[model samples]
Target: MDAKEKPETTSSMPQRRPDCIKCFDALWFCYSPFHQMQNYYRYGEFDNCFGKWGDLVDCLALKTKRAAEAEEILIAREKAKPHIWTFRTVDEASENWWRMYKHLVLMSPPLPGAAQPPPRSDKS
Candidate 1:
């Protein structure tokens, strides 16, 4: 055998995943439709993949060692978001926008400390 014909070995091959990305990819795959459907057909429900989720969480927490703190912070941030912050259809979103800022809409009081504009004319 010649040098050009040398066989490749595991040590010389590139790794499928060399970082935390592997854990993330595995977690995503666990949540994919194909995997979930297969699991559902066999087990009547999706695979929880809690171990994969834990692996990714652990991998990320390795950097700051603050997994619990991070989860709390995320939950707090979610709770602090405005009602309009969530995604909705155009009609649904545009409707009832006033509910989010009812305080700002002084319909009854009608323009405090400011003069009312001139009324519209039919001419134009």
Candidate 2:
């Protein structure tokens, strides 16, 4: 019989793995700089080209700092867990926290105009 026609013989595949929070965090952390750069390059509204470049550099530095901090937290968590019973939960929480942190980092900050009040008049 054709393989297609025969009953499935192989064991059913396992459930698709949930996104590993740690992996997701790392992915977001890595993606932020590129995303910010793309947005800035595409929009091109800044007063000077150099300012945009500076923003890009700043964004990259921010992402790098975040990644380093996350790594430190992960290392600390691993070191603190001597017993196995709590290991799985602690690891999962750490991964989720890191992932959420990454997500926050990837999110674009409020537009400058949105955050800043209009320039005040000297007469006041």
Candidate 3:
């Protein structure tokens, strides 16, 4: 077979992912019709290849390891602009944000210079 007559093959191509900066999470992307159609050519039913909790965890681990190797703590936060979408109502959107704020407050570690909680008293 002549080289010029051979059909084009993608064997030498690298894997690709959609640059979804607006994506929230894996489930959201996986269920999104837009993403489904976008990735239809590469991966039809495997949306997790781009976005997943495990992928985030792995990224954190790698970053942490690299920071430790460099003798630096990975303590940083980026203020992100929230994505706006139509909710049931303005009240519903406010409530959703309030709930997320509460969750963060409960789960986050004490901030620097914040009062430490009282030590737990154990009864023998």
Candidate 4:
């Protein structure tokens, strides 16, 4: 085809398919209309069933990962608390404490974007 006649391509090309088995499994679980419709009522959207499910699954997976990361950070902070010097002022520590607590609460399981737990590796 002539350069002038070549099809115009945009930067918003579709993404490549995910290779992770967990992601695929999550996607499969989301494909059914029964599930999608229930989720639609619980969440939102209707017409784009499969796409919506895929998006939900992906979001869940990311949320799970982030939650896990946040938990680890919390643990590390707790472990280092003794050695780490804190603010001498009560208000400073109180503010920091509340911020950390809020983050932990937000990271807890079932939080929005929290992914369903992956299947146990021991299961056959």
Tens-digit lDDT string for candidate 2 (3-82)? 67977645574322223454445445445766557656888632334544554554454455555464565566668978
Q: For candidate 3, write residues 1-124 as lDDT tens digits.
A: 8877988766675333323333336646666777777778676553555446555554555444543342322222112434475346765665556556766655788798964433344733
Candidate 1, superposed: residue stretches over 4 Å from native: 1-18, 65-124
TM-score of 4: 0.24
lDDT, each prediction: 0.69, 0.52, 0.52, 0.59
User: Which of 2 and 4 is the better model by lDDT?
Assistant: 4
User: In model 3, which runs have C-alpha deviations exceeding 4 angstroms?
Assistant: 1-31, 41-54, 66-124
Taking all chains together, the TM-score of candidate 2 against the true structure is 0.19
Candidate 4: stretches off by over 4 Å: 1-19, 47-124
The numbered model that scores best in lDDT is 1
Candidate 2 wrong stretches, greater than 4 Å: 1-11, 21-31, 43-124
lDDT of 2: 0.52
Tens-digit lDDT track of model 4 for 1-124: 7778977656455323334566656666676787778878987875454664665565455455655464565466558777655445775565556556756655675667854443335624
Q: Is candidate 1 or candidate 3 better by lDDT?
A: 1
Clashing pairs in 1: none
Backbone clash count, each prediction separately: 0, 0, 0, 1
Predicted candidate 2: what Cα RMSD to the true structure?
Answer: 18.8
